[model samples]
Target: MPRYDFRCRECGSTFEVSRTMNAASDPARCPDGHDDTVKLLSTVAVGGRGAAPASGGGCCGGGCCGG
Candidate 1:
């Protein structure tokens, strides 16, 4: 299950719901029993190891130089 963030316009409260991707667009009710809600754009965080930093600085500290 994926968590989705929603904001209730009636009470101006934010809440989260866990549901399947198929039902991601479904309307969510707030904890205060408010039916008027809108899904909020969520940010995805990626974890795990990425490319190691360049050893020596060449251009832009070798970070963007792909050294």
Candidate 2:
């Protein structure tokens, strides 16, 4: 399951929900029991919290200099 942020335009409230990827884009009902909710664009951090920073150097990380 993945967490998704939703905003209810009907009530002007925001909420989060954890659902299967299959239903990630499904319409959401606000806590106030309102519809017209929309999914928010989220900033996803790969590797979870406190994960190690990616190693390697070079602009492209391939060390080929992109040439």
Q: Model 2, residue 37: what's the lDDT? A: 96
Which ranges of candidate 1 are over 4 A from the true structure? 51-67
**Number of the top-ranking candidate, with TM-score as the measure:** 1
* Cα lDDT computed for each candidate against the true fold: 0.90, 0.89
Consecutive 10-residue window with the lowest summed lDDT within model 1:
45-54
Error of 1 at 47 (Å): 4.0
| Best candidate, lDDT | 1
- lDDT for predicted candidate 1 compared with the true structure: 0.90
- lDDT at 5, model 2: 96
* Residue 64 error, candidate 2, Å: 18
Per-model TM against the reference: 0.70, 0.64
Question: What clash count goes with each model?
Answer: 0, 0
Model 2 agreement with the true structure over 5-60: per-residue lDDT tens digits = 99999878899999999999899899999988999999866787779878688776
